[model samples]
Target: MRTAYGVETVRATERQLMARLPEGTLMQRAAAGLAVASADLLGRVYGSRVVLLVGSGDNGGDALYAGARLARRGAGVTALLLAPERAHAGGLAALRRAGGTTVHSPAGGRAAGATEGAADRPAGGSASDPAERPAGGPAGPTAAEVLIERADLVLDGIVGIGGKGGLRPDAARLAEAAERSRAAVIAVDLPSGVDADTGQVHGAAIRADLTVTFGTHKPGLLIDPARDFAGTVRLVDIGLDLPEEPALEALQHADVARLLPVPGPESDKYRRGVVGIAAGSARYPGAAVLAVAGALHGGAGAVRYVGPAGDAVLARFPETLVSDLGPAKAGRVQSWVVGPGAGDDAATVAQVLEADVPVLIDADGLRLADRDTVRARTALTLMTPHAGEAAALLGVARAEVEGARLSAVRELAARYRATVLLKGSTTLVAAEEGAVRVNATGTSWLATAGSGDVLSGLAGSLLAAGLPARDAGSVAAYLHGLAGRYAADGAPVGAQDVAKAIARAWRDVRD
Candidate 1:
């Protein structure tokens, strides 16, 4: 499992580490890692044009220090100071000592190459000093823009993890310029203008090709909107002791493999576990077929299905035990999966809720399941809904749910007193409390019709196999996402294709 912490936790931990270490030791370690990553991205440091967008905080310090290292290696480094006076004094000196030059932004009331020395401005020299001028003298408003466009790489330090509400007008212009440039943009720590804690982008933000984060992964780097802004993420260990609890967690192949169910030597059909699927109507019998297709490959020993689409399900998966007596009389089942295609079947949803076993709810079932009844259930309840469905449950717009997926999933879990799996660009599974699990193994091609029905059945099967509500939902999401990738393979695929690939995904995980 990969863990991420919020900004407050990171800052607190940093303070503790800083207290024990020498004054500038932490900064040096961060700068060393940043320099190495930058060098790797550049491929060749000598003779490269590197531009640093310097702000007024430690974020700028990291960029400046890293730029200094590159300068020592023969790169023509230029620090485009957005705040000349406020830039890190020690970092500025280091860059100067290593043959790097400084350029103030046009809005800074000085033209390009207004060299500021160690403790003074080139010893009685000023912006117009001929002794310390750049190759071309004093370019105008377009100076900063031209510099960034011509550079081989641009380090975005306009804002850091603490920045919120997006970029200011001047910084936004620089970001736009960088976007137009062919430079490989590397954001320091995080892309500016995104909420480091919530992963929300309010306004203009930097689009980085690679983001080198220090200490630990920030929640924003793992979540969306902000995640979309952050391209490839590389974590550099600065060695800070973090608390055990994390703000969020993402399950990798090893984590999912450990959570998978393995049958014992004495296991029989009933001993392994039976999943009961209550789904589909005459109008949407394919939902039942697809759900059963997924359940059959889900590690469940047997499947018992109850709904009006019994014939269609039996035709596709003859192994399924079909019944028309509803979920109540549907023999014995370790867990129940409700609400894929059963349009307006409130009675069936209610009946499944009353059962003493765990229940997995999805699709039209989200609309039909009674909120009070779900909360009152003694057994675990897992609800899976896409952005639109989750929006309806939260009484908000779909865009709202998509923008703040973490908050929306957590709110739903708390309100319903159940585990929620909010499916989108980043699939999130959250219980009322604890770390939210995120899954990014899915492909965009997984957006086909009846795809969610397959996920519901898979999760229900895991629940039946005795995984807790959170683990069942998270593991199901991981497998379903991996299956989607294998089935799609860079092209379009149907829900059945995804279902058939679950076994392949299972093997991939186990091995």
Candidate 2:
């Protein structure tokens, strides 16, 4: 499992490490990593045009130091100072000593870069002083903007994890110019203007090509909105001794393989556990068929399905023990999967909640089931809701749920008193307690119709095989996402196709 900590926890660890180490040791380590990564990205350090957006913080120090290393290696480096006087004093001196030049994104500018923090002058520089001139240098901040536009790489140190809210007008304008540049933008730790604790992007923010985080992973790098702004993430270990518990976790292939249920020599059809699926209807018989298709691949020994689409389900999986007598008379099952395509079937949804086995609820089941009734259940209950469904449960707009997916998923789990999975760009599974798991798999093509139905059946089957609600939901999400990616390849795929690819995903994980 890959873990991420919130900004406070990271700060606490940083303080602990800093207290024991010599002054500036941590910064030097961070700078070394950043410089190495910058060089790797540039391929050839010499002759590379590197631009650094220097703010008044340690993050700026990190960028400046890295730029100094590059400058010493024969690269033409320029630092565009957001706070000319307040920039890291040591970092500025080092860059200047390494044949690097400095410019200022001074307040106000021509209408060209004036959207947010527009500078007053053109991209020019004041590097005429013997100690301030860059190699192949141009004069001042006006020239710096053009350097930014023509540079091979741009290091965004405008703001760090501690900074909050949107970008100031001048910063926003620079962010815009950075985007227009063909340079591969690399954020020092995190993109400026994004919340470090929560992955929320309030206003204009730097969208980086790669974010080289120091010490530990930040929660914002793992969650969305902010995560979206953070293109690809690369961790640079500065050796901070963090705590055991994490704020969030992502399951790797090895973790998933360990969680998978494999049949033993003594395994029998009934011994492996049976999954009861209460889904589909006359209106959408395909929902039932697709749900069973997924359940059939789940590690369950047998599947007992109860709903109006009994015939449709059995027609597709011939192995399912189909029943039209509802969940109460669905015989014995280790776990139950409710909702999906069951439109207006509140009674059936209620009956499944009373079962002694673990229950996984989805789709219309989330709408039809009583909130108090689900919370009162003694057995494990897993609720899966997309942003829209989660929004209804939380009494907020869908945009609100999607914007703060981590908070929204945690709230849903706490309020419903069950493990909750909020599906979207990042599939999150949160238990009433413990670190949340973010699904890093899947493709945009997986957003097609009936995908959730397949997810419900697979997770429910895992519950029958005895995984806890949290594990069941997260593992199922992992497999479902991988399957969707495999099935989609580079094109659109139906839910059934995703269902069929579950075994392939399982094989891929185990191998």
Candidate 3:
């Protein structure tokens, strides 16, 4: 599992580490890692021109120190101090000691390198000094912009954990210039202007080609928006003694593989686990067929279909035991999957919920059930609601759910007292206990009608196969998403195709 700690959590960890280490030890570790990464991006530090956008916090300090390192290694490094007077004293001294030049406003530009009288002034040095003063509107294009445009690489140290939402005027302008430049951008820690906890872009954020984070990963680096801006992420250990809660998580293929049910040789069909599926009706029997198709490929030993569409299910999957007595009489099952083309049938949904086994509620089931009853369930329950359905369940607008997916999923889980899977551009699975997992795979093409039905059945089957409610939900999502990608193979695919692709996905994962 890959972990992502929140900003506050990271700060706490930083504090703990600070207590044991030297005063500037963490910053030095961060700077050294950043310098090494910047060097890698430049290919060769020798003769390379590097620009450092220095802000007023530790972020700027990191850039300045890293620039110092590069300068000592034969690189031409320049520091564009946005707040020279407030800059980290140690970092500034290091940069100057290592032969890195500093640039200030036009009045102080000549000392850096500007004509006597130009619109763009050179930065650095004293504006009061007549010999160093430039006759220009200001400094030429701002030292940061000028150096960023000409340099081979740009280091963004504008904001750090201490910084708040959005960029200040100077930082924003510098970021814009860096974006337009040919120089590769390397962000220290996170890309500035992104909410480290929610992955929301506060304002214009620096889009980095790579971000070198220290100690652990930040939530924003693992999620979207901020994740998109953070092209690639690398972690640098700073030896922080953080607590467990600080280690937020993201699952990898190996982690999913471990959670998947692998049938043993001695396991019989009934011994493995049976899934009871209450889905579809005469009007929409295809939903039942699709659901069964997914259940068939899931790790479940058997699937029992109980609904008005049993005939269609039997015709499509003869292996499924067809029963008309409803979910109550569906016989013994380790888990039950409700909804998915059941078409607002409250009675059928109620019967499924009344079952003793763990249940997965989806589609119309999400709409037809009583919220309190779902919360009262003794067995494990998983609610999979797409944005629109989730919006209804939460009594909010669909746009609200889509806008803040993480919060929506968590709310749904807490409200239902079940594992909630909020399916969307970023599928989020949140447990009632507050554990959240984000699915990073799958193409946009997976958004076809009835695709969710397949996911519901797949998750239900995993539950029957004995994985915990949270694990089953997350693993099923991973499989379903992978299957969608495989089914599409770049083209549009239907829900049935996605169902068929689940078998292939299972093989891919198991093999």
Best by lDDT: 1
lDDT of each residue in 250-315, candidate 3, tens digit only: 677888878888888899888888999899988888888888888888878999998899888888
Compared with the true structure, the alpha-carbon lDDT of candidate 2 equals: 0.85
> What RMSD does model 2 have?
4.9
Per-candidate clashes, comma-separated: 0, 20, 9
Higher-lDDT candidate of 1 and 3: 1
| Regions of candidate 3 where Cα sits further than 4 Å from its true position | 104-143, 149-151, 489-491, 507-511
What is candidate 3's TM-score against the reference?
0.87
Please rank every candidate by TM-score, starting with the best.
1, 2, 3
lDDT of each: 0.86, 0.85, 0.79
lDDT of 3 at 257: 79
Give one digit per residue, the lDDT tens place, for model 1 in 346-447. Answer: 999999999999999999899999899999988999999999999999999999998888899999999999999999878999997845988888989999
Q: What's the lDDT for residue 338 in model 3?
A: 89
Per-residue lDDT of 508 in model 1: 100
Model 2: how far residue 397 lies from native, Å: 0.7
lDDT of 3: 0.79
Q: Kindly report which residue stretches of model 1 are placed more than 4 angstroms away from their true locations once superposed.
A: 106-141
